[model samples]
Target: MKSKSIGLSPKSFYYGYDSKKDLKHLVRLVLILVFIALLTGMIGIWVVYRSAHERHLDMLRAFANTQGDVLDAYMLLDEVKSGRVHGDTPHEHNLDNVKELLLKQESFLETGQLLLAYEDTSTGKYILIGTGHMPSGQHSVLVVENTRELTPSMRLALEGKEGVLEGQDLHGAPVVTAYLPISKHNAGLVVMLNQSEFYAPYHRARLITLGIGVVFVVFGTWVIWSAEQKNLRQVREREQLIRLSFENSAIGKALVAPDGSWLRANKSLVNILGYTEDELLRMDFQSITYPEDLEADLDHVQAMLKGEINVYHMDKRYFHKSGDIIWSHLSVSLVRDEQGEPKFFISQIQDITERKRVEFENQRLHERLMDQLSLRRQQLDTASGALEGFAYSVSHDLRAPLRAMSGFSQALQEEYGDKLDDTASDYIRRIHRASTNMAELIDSILRLSRTSFGELNVVSLDITAMSKRVVENCRVVEPDYPVEVRVAPGLKGQGDLRLIGSVLDNLIGNAWKYTHGVENPLIEVGQEHVTLSEQSDDSVLAFYVRDNGVGFDMAYSNKLFRPFQRIHSDREFEGSGVGLASAQTIINRHGGQIWAQGQTGKGATFYFTLNHTQFDSEKNSTS
Candidate 1:
C-alpha cells in the first residue's frame, strides 16, 4: 500500500528546503581546502628549494676556498723558483702551469670553469683568463675582453672580496659563481657552475610536487561531490515520509489552518517558541510573530493563498513565550487538496539566533575599525601640514641670519687684517667658515625635505649619458689626478631627470673625492641586471659607481644614509652627511633603494636601483 502524505507536494517540499544553499556552502568549503593544500605544497617546495640553494652555495664556497689555497701554493712555488711572485701580473709560464693544475682539478665537475683575473689599472677593467671543460679532454683558455661589463662576483673579487654569487658569465649564461681575492698577488680567482644544471633536480621536484597536489585536490573534490550527491538523493527519498516523520523531525515543523491557527505543532516548535504544543495550537501564528516581521509573513501567506507563490523562505524574528526575540530561517509553503481547495500550511523553522548575534557583532566591529581608520588619516594630514610649515620656515627665516653672519665675519677678517692680531684674524676666519658650513647644512636639509615631500615627475632617462656627464663634472673638479672613468653604454631608466642626476653626482662625486690620494685612481660606472630569484625570471637593473680609493669601516655602514651622521671624520673626508640621506629619500620616492659596500683602504661601490618597489631583493655585498 502506498502511504499518503498530508498537505505538501514533492515540488513544494524541494523548493522550500535549502538544499541548493547547503550544496553551495559545501562547494565553497571544498574550494577553500583545495586552496590550502596547494598553498602548503607551494610552501614546501619553496622550503626545499631554499635549503638546496643554501647547501649548494656552501659547497661552492668550500670548493672556491680550496682552489684559492691551491693557487696560493702555486704562487709560493713560483716565488721559490723565480725569487719573486706578482699575482696581479704573474709570469706567463708560471700562469700557464697554474692554469694546467686548476684545469686538472676541474675535471671532477661536469659544467665548471676556473677563472683567473687581474684588474688592468690602465683602463679600470678586468682581464679575464679562463679554462673550461672541452669535449676532447683538453682544456680551453679564453681571454675575455676588458670591454665586457664586470659581473658582481668579478667586481667584488677584484676589490679583495671573497664570496659565492649567482650571476651571468662572460658569455651571458646564467651561472653560480665563487670568487676569491688573492691578497698577496693582488689578483682574483673565480669558479663558475651552470645555474640551470645545478638547480634542475629541484625544479623538477617542484613540478612533480605541484602535479601531485593538483591530482589530490581534484580527486578529493570528486569524492566530496559524490558523497554530497548521494546525500541529496537520500534527502529526496526521505521527503516521501515527511508526514510520518513530522513529529520526530529536528527542525521545528507545524501544520497551520487557512485562518492562521496552528492545527498541530511538533516538539521542536514548542521548544523553539518556549511554549507547550497545546498553548501554541490555541494561539494564531500572527500573535507570536514579531510585530516587525508579521506584515511580511502575512504578505507571503496572502501570495501563497492567491496561487502567486508555492513556497517562500526568509530570515524572520519570532516573539518567544518568555518575551525574547528568536531569529530563525523560516520556510512556509501552501498545501492544496485534490479538489483545488486551499488546505493547511506546512512551516519549517531552524534556530539561527547565534548566527544573527555574531553577524551584528561583526558589523559593530567593522564600524569601529572604519572610525579608527578615519582618525588615523586625519592625524596624518595634520602632521603633513606641520612638516610643510616647518620646511617653509627653515627656507625663509633661517637663511638671512646665516648669510649676514658669514658676510660680517668675512668683512672683519678682510678690512681689519693689519689692525687685528693674528689670533683675532684666525678667530674671524673660523667664524666665517662656521657660518658658511651652517648655510651649506641648511641647503642640504632643504634638499632632503624637497626630495622627501615633492611630487614625482617620471620620464624615460638615458642613464648612461647622465652618468657620463656626472663623471665629467667630477673630472672637471679635480683634473690633476687623471682618474680613469668608464661609463657603460645604452643604460636606461624611468625617473625625474634632475633628481636622478643629483643622485649620480653625489655618488660619483664622493668616489672622486675619496680616490684623490690613490695611485691609478679608477672610477667605473656600470649596471648589473640581477635576477629576482631562481624561481622567477624577473630581473632588476642595479647601477653602481665603483672606485679604487679610500673606503669606510663596514661596522658603521648603517650610518651612511643618516643625516649629519658620518662614518669618517671631517679631517679624513669632507661631506655634508646629507647627500646619501637625500639620495635614499629620492630613491624611495621612485620606488627603489640605495646602498653601499666598502672596506677601509680598498674602495667603495654605491649601488642603487630605480622603480623597484621591493628593496629586499638579493644583491652581493661589495668589498
Candidate 2:
C-alpha cells in the first residue's frame, strides 16, 4: 500500500521552482542578438570604407610626389642635353641622368610602369618617346606611347617652362606627364615622366581589407544582441507582475512628473475621472479644476511646500473625456528627491461625485426651509404689530369710561343707597370691579404697543452705564425696595439707544418685580468677552443681567419670546408677560441674540449677544 501523505510529500514536490522553456523566445532572442551583431557590423563597414578611401588617396599623393620628382630629374636631363646643366653631356647625357633617378625611386613603384613624354610644339601633340626602370614592390612597371595622341607635352629637351598632360598611354595604363621647358641657344627642350601606375596594387589591397572588416563586424554585432535578449526576457517577466498589481489596487493611482507630465496612470484613476489614462495625462490639474476650486488647490499646494501639510486631501473636479465633470476626493503625497526637494506627486483618488450630488441637494432643501420659516416669521411680526396697535387704541380709549363707571357707581352708592337694596349695591360694586380689571388689561396692552412702535436713538452706548441708569430709575420708582446692581465698566456696543434702554428697562424691571417678597433683591450686571472658537479666530462680547427673581422652567425656553406665553399665572404675578418678549424683539432688531437661563424661584440670568464680529476680526489680528 502507498503511504498516505500527511502534507506535501517529498516524492511529489520538487525542492524549488524551475523555469518553463519558451522555444519561440529562444529563437527570438537569437534573432535580436544577430541583429545587434549586424548593427556593429555596419559600424565596422563604415570604418573600413573610410580607411580604404584614405589609403587609396595616400597612394595617389605618393604617386603624384614621385611623378613631380621624376619630372624634375628629366628636366635636369634636358638641361644637360642642351649643355645648360653642369654635367659631362654627350657621353653622360640627359637620358642617362633620368634613368638613374627613376631607379632610386623604384622601391615605391610596386609593379607599375613609368614612361616619359614631352610636347612637340610643332605638332601640338604629346609623344611618349622614352622608358625607365624602377625597383620592385606590390606593382610592376612598363612604358608605353599613346595611340590617341593629342597635346604637346612630349618634346625631348624642354626643361625650363611648365607644361602639364594627363591621359592613358597606348597600353591603357593611366599616366600623368609633366614637362619643364628648356631654352638654350634658341632651342626648346622638356623632360616628362609617368607616375599613377605605381598606386594600383595598394588600391586593390585596401578593397580586400574592407571586405574582411565587413564580415567580422557583422559577426560581433550578433553576439551583443544575444546578451540583450537575456535582459529583455527578465524585463518581460517583471512586467507581468507589475500588471497584476496595478489592475487590482483599490485606490486610483497616478504618477505625475514635476512639470505636470504624466508618467503613468492606473485604471482606477481613469474610472474616477471618467477619462482614459491617455486623456487625463494629456492635461494638467489647472485644466480640469473648477475656477472656484483652483485657489484652494493652490493654497494647499503652497502649504505643502512650506511644510504645513505632509499629505493633502481635497475634493476637486476633473472634466471627463466625455465632457462631463467628475468629482474626486484625492489624497496626494509629495515624493521628494534625496536633497528634500519635491520631485513629483503621487495621487490616490476616490470618486465622490455621488456624495457631492446628495450634499448639494440637501443644501438646497435646507435653504428652502429657511426661506419658508422667514416668511412665516415676517407674517407673525406684521400681525403682532397690528395687535399692539389695536391694544394701544383700546387702552387709551377705554380708560375714561372705566373711571366714569367707577365714579358713577360710587355716586349711586352715596346718593341712592336707601332706594337700592344691599344686593343691588353689591351688583354695582361687582360691575365696578370688573371694569377696573378691564382698565388694567387695556393699560398692559398699551405698554406692549409702546414697545412695538418705540423710537430708537441709535448710538454707541456703554451697557455698563445704561444698566446702572436702569437700576437707579428702578430705585426711584420704589424708594424702599431693596435692589443690588453690579455693572462692569467699559461694556460698549453699537445699537439703538432707546431700544437698548428698553431692553434694560424691561429686564431690570422684571428683576425688580419678580424679586418682590424677597428679603433683598439681588441684581448683578456684568460683561465678559468669550471666544466662540478654540483658536479665538472669532470672539463675541456678551452682557448678562442676573436677578434673584421668579424664573421659569427650562423646558419652555423656546416659548419665552411669544407674547403672553408666561409660565407664571397673572393672578400670581400681575404682568402682561410681554416684557421679556419685547426685550427679545428689540435685541433681535439690533441683530443680536437674547437668551434666558433660570430655575423656578432660584433666579434668572438674562444674557444678550451683540455681534461685534468686526471688532473681533480687528482684535484677533492685533493679538
Please identify model 2 stretches exceeding 4 Å from their true place: 1-426, 449-458, 528-542, 548-574, 588-604, 610-623
RMSD of 1: 57.5
- Candidate 1, which segments miss by more than 4 Å at Cα? 1-352, 454-505, 519-545, 588-593, 608-623
Judged by lDDT, which candidate is best?
Answer: 1
| Candidate 1, 112-162: lDDT as tens digits | 777777655555655565667432244655444553455678768878998
Model 2: per-residue Cα lDDT over 1-623, one tens digit each: 11122122222112122233344655566667666756776677668767864665455545544665655656665785687665533322453454455445443334234444444344544433333332223222323243234224433224434544554444455555444433422122222234445335446655775577556655654664566557566765666556556655677877655444554567887776676776765667667777778888778777776668899999988777676787889887776666886655677777788899999989888989899989987987788777876776687678888889988988888899789988999998998888887776676566656666655556898888898899888888788876767777787888888778888988888877888876677888886554555875565556888888877788888888777788877787767777877788777777677887888878888888765563466468657
How does candidate 1 fare on TM-score? 0.48
> Where is the poorest 10-residue window by lDDT in model 2?
1-10
Provide TM-scores for the models: 0.48, 0.41
Backbone N/Cα/C clashes per model:
0, 38
